[model samples]
Target: MFKDLLKTHLFPTSWCPGCGIGGIMAQLAMAMDEMGLNQSNSVVVGGIGCTGRMAGYFNLDSVYTLHGRTLPVAQGIKMVNPSLKVIIISGDGDLASIGGNHLIHALRRNVDLAVLCNNNEVYGLTGGQAGPTTPQGTPTVSSPDGSPYEPLNLQGLLKTGSRYFYARTTVYHQVHLKRCIKEAIQWPGFAFVDIASQCIENNGRRLGFKTGYEMLAMFRDKYKRAPDGVESLAPLEIGLVKRGEEQP
Candidate 1:
């Protein structure tokens, strides 16, 4: 059934062998499949990055927007046809860097949109540059010595709104990742799902990881779900946080 949601003819996506973007795409497709979402009711908007290519693979209508413009475009689409479901897929750099101003306004407006950010931490497509979400001291092509700045506080930023929905999950956590996508799609207002994913050929190798599987193993060991009812999540915890008409 999930295969029906994908343009399987586009098999062997440009994403590198063992790249986590493929995993994110598959899981998202599966989630959409389970949700009864299709070409008639939904659209996927992608940004400029490896993750942006995901939009092309979806069987549903998709928009390939300019760098960092996915949000505003998605917002426009939502505003024009409030009945259609708009979902955005983009990388950390696209969303947190160039598109940051839009991210803030989108959160403040609490528009009915679902954003799935592939937080791989580095700009994988453009020669592995340090991105906004790249952790401090992480080595990259641009930061040969290591990134000197702290990563963006996405959780804190998302939580700034009076009513918000944020969920954190990693690509390695298959079940959780799909669940996060599904729930975010169902959330009434703006929903952001920060998906910690691997950029094996770029970020992973620079971090001394031998393979994508190794990176995945590290995620499996390093992250865990927070207890239910927690107001906020810690750096290593993965869970949902909401403040709206219904309790978190």
Candidate 2:
């Protein structure tokens, strides 16, 4: 019965074949189930783009906010109904670009909500443009000559503003992803889980990867590990480079 609630008719989604977004949705639903959060107590907030469509699929209350404004909308929901468990789902461009301010401010205020950032490294829904997290030298429709700028370190940036529980996971690591979401949901203050999803049709093809699963596998091979100091290695590193602090 609990699992049935997580199923969404949105299957055979618009996302490209093997897109990691579906895996992310599954993990989130599983986490909610494990935490015993039902539709009555849960509310999903989302911004524009493929990630934003998650609001339509979730069985719980949802608000499909304007582009890059999910966090602010989520804040309002939490403020009015403190008992509701709010989860904000957004894409890379939505969260780290136009909505960047809202993302950081939400962390500063330490609002009681969970953030699930699907970092696909490109603006998938918008004709495959180079997004804020696009790595250097990655070719995109906007960057025909390859993007020159460095990618934003999402986990590190989030750690600088708030003291909330933070974790970074990938669709490849299903167990870790599920565990991270569960932990973030349980944390009292604002919690964030940056999911390294794959835009197979956009970023993947540009990088010579055939499918989203391949991209997820690459992330697992390269950056799969917990941050240092904790008994368990976090999915990715957190915190900024302090003046005298040792780098993780």
| Candidate with the greatest TM-score versus the true structure | 1
Q: Per-residue lDDT tens digits of candidate 1, residues 50-109?
A: 999999999989999999999999999999999898999999999999999999999999
Error of 1 at 113 (Å): 0.6
Q: Summarize candidate 2's per-residue lDDT along 56-89 as a digit string, tens digits.
A: 7888778889999999999988999999999888
Q: How high is the CA lDDT of each candidate model? A: 0.93, 0.79
Off by more than 4 A, model 1: none
Q: Tell me how far the alpha carbon of residue 68 in candidate 2 is from the true structure, in angstroms, after superposition.
A: 0.6
> For model 1, what is the C-alpha lDDT against the true structure?
0.93
Q: For each candidate, what TM-score against the reference?
A: 0.98, 0.89
Among the numbered candidates, top lDDT falls to: 1
What TM value does model 1 have? 0.98
Pairs with steric clashes in candidate 2: 226-233, 226-234, 227-234
Report clashes for each candidate as comma-separated counts.
0, 3
